[model samples]
Target: MTTNSKYNFKWEDLGDIRLGRPNLGTNTHVAVYRLMQYTMRDVLEKQLGPDKTNLFFIDAGFKAGVEFCKNILDCTLGFDDFGANLADKLLEFGIGVLRFEKADLEKMSFLLTVGEDLDCSGLPYSGVAFCDYDEGFIAGIMHQYTNLNFEVKEIDCWGTGDRTCRFAVELAKS
Candidate 1:
């Protein structure tokens, strides 16, 4: 119900991976990441219920996205260039293959897709969209770039029997 007051996350919390893991390096198996994610989801769902668990993931992801944008992205670029940079960074980080399906710069609305998404690309069909965190992540990135709140919804996901994750992003109504 309340946030912890003693600690706030900073990008520095990631630490020096090269210095720390000189032998292992930066890369790890995707399954290992999913193991932590799914297990945490399971415990959180049991304790907080599915809705709240999703919210927690989204909120955490939003924080991460904001930090990521601030640290990794070049915010000075134009919209098109920003998108291209973001796509490149996502791929470089092994996050996903980001593609813009549609864009309406005047309306601040867009449709985007991430293929081979880190979260749920190979997941079995579960009849539910499993990318609430991704939704918040995109919104956070957009917010950081444009200084505007966005409403991001995952419309298709591997959990929903879709091959790629699709999202609709629009400026949030004030």
Candidate 2:
């Protein structure tokens, strides 16, 4: 909300939201966070429809992921170290636990699980996958880290009655 800058949004712009609430630093109830996300999603769906709303969310998450990688991750690490560091950082920030089921560097394909994800960890079954934003986030991080494009898709979600969110990641074909 400061002066319009020449550059895109940066992480520092998220200046400690707990500025005055030292007692509640970086700890908000999941219900409140879900309320904010779901309410905004409800409004976006009402105005833009489901498809467009999903796109908007994915776009937003993509930007966030790019910024997060630039600010928080070391992009120079090799494949194994990269994933391990990412997992550690995600856990440190309480984003989730990352478990790679498969990682084929030659094929640029990966299968992973996000346990207790912020997006849809405990949500009631909605019959559809609810991790489009997460897909974009994963793709963005991978793109920034590897300087390559990837297709990251969420195949299972808590919203789809899955205990953990499972995502399939593959290099995008040219």
Q: What is the per-residue lDDT of model 1 for residues 24-132, given as tens digits with 9 covering 90 to 100?
A: 9999999998999899999999999999999998888888789889999999999999999999999999999999999999999999999999999999999999998
| C-alpha-based local distance difference test score of model 1 | 0.94
lDDT of 2 by residue, 29-130 (tens): 877877888899999999999999999888878888898899999898998998999999989988889999999999999999999998889989989888
**Error in Å for residue 28 of model 2:** 1.3
- Which ten-residue region of model 2 has the weakest summed lDDT? 1-10
Q: How many backbone clashes does candidate 2 have?
A: 0
- For all candidates in order, the CA lDDT equals 0.94, 0.89
Which pairs of residues clash in candidate 2, taking residues 3 or more apart in a chain or in different chains?
none
Off by over 4 Å in 2: 3-7, 17-20
Backbone collision tally, model 1: 0
